[model samples]
Target: MPKQIEDQKKILLRVRKISGQVQAIERALIEQKNCDAILQQICAARGAMNGLMHELLEVHLKDTLVVNQSSEQERSEELQNISKILKSYLK
Candidate 1:
């Protein structure tokens, strides 16, 4: 299996729960559930996706960038790039 899938297995429970929550949200919509409640679920799912992205980005920064940085200048440049990425992503 790919490394991402392998890594996901370790966190399978959270992923599974997120999937279930999405399914529930879909059902709620079909059943004409409260708009506020459906929106709350949508917000929760968005937060969950963001959490997953942050985890993957953290691993990439540590395992790839940290390993390859051989000089203070290189490391500083990487940090600057990462900061820029974060700013763009947040925007």
Candidate 2:
């Protein structure tokens, strides 16, 4: 796991990317791009937003529950399993 500062940096980068995606969508709208093209851009923006959500959720889980819940093997295993589930979910 990384320090909170590192996690924050990563999270912020994702957020920035998501913002850019949204701005692109707005620009497309203003330019009156084709419907299909606009929809594709919307999908891309949605995917970026989902990715951001995924990153933020993982950080929240690690910081809020996994970090100090326990030092036992069971806790570690639980974290790993949850991580796997999350990865599968995003896919």
Q: Which portions of model 2 show Cα errors greater than 4 Å?
A: 1-3, 69-91
User: Candidate 1, after superposition: displacement of residue 84 in Å?
Assistant: 7.2
lDDT of 1 by residue, 1-91 (tens): 1145656574565578789889989999999999999999999988887877687677657655665646888778878988898999899
List per-prediction Cα lDDT, in the order shown: 0.76, 0.81
Query: Could you tell me which 10 consecutive residues in candidate 2 have the lowest summed lDDT?
Result: 63-72
Candidate 2: tens digits of C-alpha lDDT, residues 1-91: 4349989999888888888888988998999889899899889888887887778777877875667566678677777878897788769
TM-score of 2: 0.69
Screening candidate 1 with a backbone cut-off below 3 angstroms (N, C-alpha, C), the clashing residue pairs are none
Give candidates' CA RMSD values in order: 3.7, 5.0
Instruction: Score residue 2 of candidate 1 by CA lDDT.
Output: 15
Residue 66 lDDT in model 1?
66
